[model samples]
Target chain A: MEKKFEIKDLITVGVFSALYSIVMFAVACLGFIPILMVFMPLLCPLVAAIPLMLYFSKIKHFGMITITGTLIGILMFIIGHPYPILIFCIGAGLLTEVVLKMGNYQSIKHCVAASAVFSLWFLGMVIAFFFSFRDAYFASILDGYGQEYVDAMKSYTPTWVFFAMIIMCLVGGTVGGLLGAKVLKKHFRKAGMA
Target chain B: MEIGVCSNKNGAFIKLDPRSKLLLLITISIIMIGARTVEVEGVLRLICAAIPLVLLLSIREYKASFIYLLLLGSALICEKHIAPYTHGICNIVLMMICGLITRFVAGYMMGWYTVKSTSVSEFITAMERMHCPSFISIPMSVMFRYFPTLSEEYKSINDAKRMRELGHPFSQPLTYIEYILVPLMMSTVRIADELSAASLSKGLSAGEKRTHICEVSIRPLDVFAITGTMVMFVLFLVY
Candidate 1:
């Protein structure tokens, strides 16, 4: 079967890729405390807003989404955020895709949960890569500064960080769904994608 | 569609095969990075870095190359006087920026080149021709195409952040993180699935040998560029 390639599809890809990269660049630019990025708000919400996955659910695009993720990975990798950033992205992306599938793309709960799980994987990767143990080696670079770095470590806990991350992810996902639902629903209506 | 970043250069720089460019970037990057201390090694790296700057100028990509040198120069300046005052932030920022600039330029050039000549099918085929594992090539090809997609997503995420932050008096870093990650992750999962399905529907079988739409050849221009790269690279090293 000779399938016609739509110029519009390419346009769509271009738009989304650009949007995705911008989101990553903005949030990822600001350094965090732990250091968690204070700009996480700018990033997660926008990403969650785009209904790319929902569109995928109806269509299941082949290389489009993965390619976007890969570009983001390369951009950051080029920027030098250590190895875990890339690892987390790939790991978390896969996890989210799996979770989305688990829900059969029929339930909003599954989508939200999937995004949360996806982000958690990245958080976990960060902890494992930087710290020796939970709360034991929280501030990675400060470990060398000894008491100076360690002195301030007392302001938080691993559980707190985890909970914070989960909340953030939840908010992010919810917002993402809200934003994505409209565009993606329209996208799905204009079908033959999957 | 540009295959590599060099296309933007538009001169002799763009004439070289992407493979050569990759080789040059890798070799130069390793040597520069290997210069352990700023004294003997750092000085050498600075000199070596100049060669690329000149090539960039000749290619008319002076701006990009200048940005690269600026990073190295700033690092040198910072390491000399501001090291202790800034608590090493200057050095760290400089090194990372330098690293980022080099990779970004190299990737850009290669990406430009790939798009100009090779079709997606050709790229996949070439990997197979080179004896690359399907597992590896499939992912690489996927990643290559994905680059633009990711960049796009980042753009939207950035805009959303801008909107929210601007809404408030002083947007903190925490606020940014809270919003960005959610959308970014959401978009990622969405597209990945669609792309996977689309590629599948296209019957993108990895096992089959593919065809090449663009002929890849090493021209005299490539030789000249590489030779120029070597001489300058050596001059920088020994200087």
Candidate 2:
């Protein structure tokens, strides 16, 4: 139950959470390709561990990830993305920390597994939310976009086409995160931080 | 022949302070968003913005931005000339150009206001900007720092082969993406060792306060630019 992070790490997480809102908002302005949007945070998580590892690599950094995850959750809510993004982040981070406690983080397998778990974390939340509240979720997306592009945005013609896009985003995000982690593993080592 | 990616101009821009650049980027972006659609307005915006952007890119003498420009220009032509079955090419091109002009405005503001002043600082302040922990910036910046260099290395590695670059752009873009991946990853593995050493030498531990040399003050020039952009934006909104 003891927190493993320093004060500044918390501040960093808060700043990044705020950044997510603006970055997503800006991306929304440019395009709506779900594939890219889903994987958008891939790069963030890729190198996200460096700071914690760099500073608190000595102390447990799992709790630090949870706090950052909460910040991201708050930021997403402010940015109008609904609530589960927060829950996914915390649960994923904490679980990854548990895995790390098993001494798995040192190897490439651990990084990849941690990434996959979180990737699934986001996917599970999106899918569950879609099933539980299909109409509301679709309505919110439409509200975010509006009725004008509502029809076009839904590439699938069936009423069920509504939730298909979320699945697509999740798939894209999962792939992107895996790729990001793999790439990150190499890059961090090259940068000499590993 | 590669398109849509920025050049090393960002590295130089990173030298400037961040606050100054943010004001510049936001102001210009507001103006661009405001003036997103008019034809005459679009072309004028392109010119006013393009001049500075070209000068920035010129420092690097990088052809990537020019190629991107060429692709954008060609896309406009295609959207006008080919994509629309009903409208004439001229009309489509005109509409496309008008839409693109807003991005030009946004692009220039990014370069002049934010990038020129605080390009490097963006990486350091990225967490603050993104809601992540500052701990992440070390790896993020390291990745960014090495990315362009790796790209350059990848390009040279490709030149060692024949038919890869020329054949990919005109004949197959996916081929281009495919060919580039291996070298980039290999380069990543090779460089990872060095990055680790560099970070360790610097004692880059998490929760540490990293210094930012890129300081951007909202100067008189910045105020004038913001005011001018806001006025123009208001005019566009009303008109």
Candidate 3:
């Protein structure tokens, strides 16, 4: 019989996705600090890698990762992120799925690679700054934050910084992936769960 | 009908259809986020904030509503009074915290209310009525039901850690985190396996559509709430 996403696989996806989002939310709380906000793209992926790698190791199905990504996007929206994030996340999920497929879903190396790729979705959280609504967004920021704070934010996040953040995300993702794999081996593998 | 009455027991004053709660959630979230980008009037913001607060109060979630009011009051006060005095980093931190609270509180409260008020079966049935695929609805329902369970599992793990006399997290961060996460993952995965087995035996994976004993209908109050929210949303856009 052809393989399909049984209830078992879907439930597993839901559970792990919840775990990933909780970890992501914990890291996201750091964004309240303006300086830390700049590094969120890196920090989120680094912190979230353990859960993502563990989730990847358990799943042999094709669309499960994509579903997890979409679900996270929806959760982000629920928590007040822009709708454009959904597009970015879905794209990242698809890319991660493709990367995992290259290794036939079993290789530890591909799992690490996929983890790095999956972390790219953090880009969605900041893409709003590059949108045409920048002026309106900044205006809102001005109203909320003082003029000095807005100026500081503008200086902190120039156009190049967006690309720099992307690079940071990839690097952080790779490092996090390696760390996550080690953690998985030391713990889950020993338990025979992964 | 039995399940409907049972679920409505919590919110006896106003029984919103699950669809209305969903609509209320979307409206509140959009207004909250868009209010920052666009020049939404203060009156509209107040109304948006009030919608959830009033609903929460009506539902008898006194503690949550009280907390929401307290946070909103403090955020507004900090923005108006306290944030002006601070300089440099202090000013930035205070303003950012206030901005986040003011920006997100309404939407967050609305989401909390929706999730708290609606049961899993009702949510799935509502999605089914809206023609969402089972793939989306099933996992969403499971995710919603699992959050509290996750927190409960974490507490138990923490209790175990304390009993084991694990080193303080600050002293040995890696070991502490590993101890917490490894057991949490193991327990969560084990729970998922058991949940799946239980659900499968309950016919959750049955190819046919499932029926709910809970009644979900768009009553007059639902119409009132939906139209009220839509009007405010349109006003926020136009003005």
Candidate 4:
């Protein structure tokens, strides 16, 4: 089979990417609860797993995953994410695509690994905390939320916590991917689609 | 239909190229994101917020622009005057409300204007002209086009669930979520397949330079908008 993305594959990518993004957006709305906002790294990937799994099952070519990532990155930027996050998102997508390629696009194990890596896109959003604006971010948090809240936040988000959040995101993705696979098997596969 | 505001010839007060609209969004987002990190001058913030409202008005989106203005005014007032007086939970809630508004509203309004005012064809043409690979442009356009369809599907699903009395959010929330997602995914796949088939038959896969009837050009207004945004961005950096 030719390894080129046809219009059908591209459109499938588009449709599924849209679904994945909508799921992500819906999950993000939960951030209205102040405490739940901190768990965004986990919640988004976990909740968004279903459509992504469906999208992955349809992937027969190389570029589909990267395209989905880039598309989502642009959407995020449009929705007010910082510009540099785009680069981070594209990198995560590319890395995930490589992981999926290692399994030749079929192995459930690789798909889970890919999901773990793809979840690093959340890292892009929080990356400013580790690198740029570390002081300003906290200062703003202090200003808006008061020193007590900032103290609570800082305690919750120490240097190690960044790595912990990364791990949490990965675990969320891994579990999500597995759950997604099961969902596909229980739903789409029995429907003779997957 | 008359394609978009770009093609509305005699109607729109200020016609902008999609490329320029995209540029304006990037500029506004950059400024607003910066505003969040450091307290920028209030005047600068106001200018940034006003850009989208003015653009919306130019497109004759009177109601949306007015609503945005009202929201911005109220949020500004609450943040400046009322927020300091509140304490504890109310304070945090007030701050959160103000922060979300200041951080997101301007960019969201600008995005709404960009998406609402520009047709998919015009967007694709702009992307193509900017030399974005068709791989990105094609799916991006399709994704843009599909958002409305997705929302429509979601509403119908909600309606169906209500009819069946199968799920409710407060009770059986997980089941309600599952009920919502499973059918949504299935219908999404089916619709995607149908859409792909239709577009393929329309020769979308022919893999040649496609001709579009929507004439997209960088008019003087577009030049002005792009340059003015860049100047503001440079000023933002320097200031």
Please name the candidate that would achieve the greatest DockQ relative to the true structure: 3
Fraction of true A-B contacts recovered by candidate 2: 0.00
* Stronger candidate by lDDT (3 vs 4): 3
Clashing pairs in model 3?
none
Superposed Cα deviation of residue A177, candidate 2 (Å): 8.7
* Model 1 lDDT, full chain set: 0.50
Per-residue CA lDDT of candidate 2, range A87-142, in tens? 66667667756655556346444544444444334443344234565565555334
Q: Model 1 segments beyond 4 Å from truth? A: A1-19, A30-42, A45-81, A84-86, A120-129, A132-171, A182-194, B1-16, B20-55, B86-210, B217-239
Better of 2 and 3 by TM-score: 3
Q: What's the residue-level lDDT of A99 in candidate 1? A: 69
| Per-model CA lDDT versus the true structure | 0.50, 0.44, 0.82, 0.81
TM-score of each model, in listed order: 0.55, 0.48, 0.94, 0.92
Q: lDDT tens string, model 2, B85-160?
A: 4344343333334444424433543543333233445546644655555545433344334434554775686785
For candidate 3, write residues B170-235 as lDDT tens digits. 798777767877787887789888989988898988878687788899999999989998898788
What i-RMS does every model get?
8.9, 10.2, 1.9, 2.6
| Maximum-TM-score candidate | 3
Candidate 1, backbone clash total: 101
Cα RMSD (angstroms) for every candidate in the order listed: 8.5, 10.0, 2.5, 2.6
Using Cα atoms, each model's DockQ against the true complex is: 0.07, 0.08, 0.60, 0.57
Judging by lDDT against the true structure, name the best candidate. Answer: 3
Q: After superposition, how far is residue A172 of candidate 4 from its true place, in Å?
A: 1.1
What's the CA error at residue A61 for candidate 2, in Å?
4.4
- Candidate 1 per-residue lDDT, tens place, B1-239, comes to 34442233344444546555545554455444333334555555555455456556555655676676666566555544454344333434443343334334433443333444334565555556567655445555555566666667757878876876533324564445445544554565566657756756755544354444454456787687678667756755574
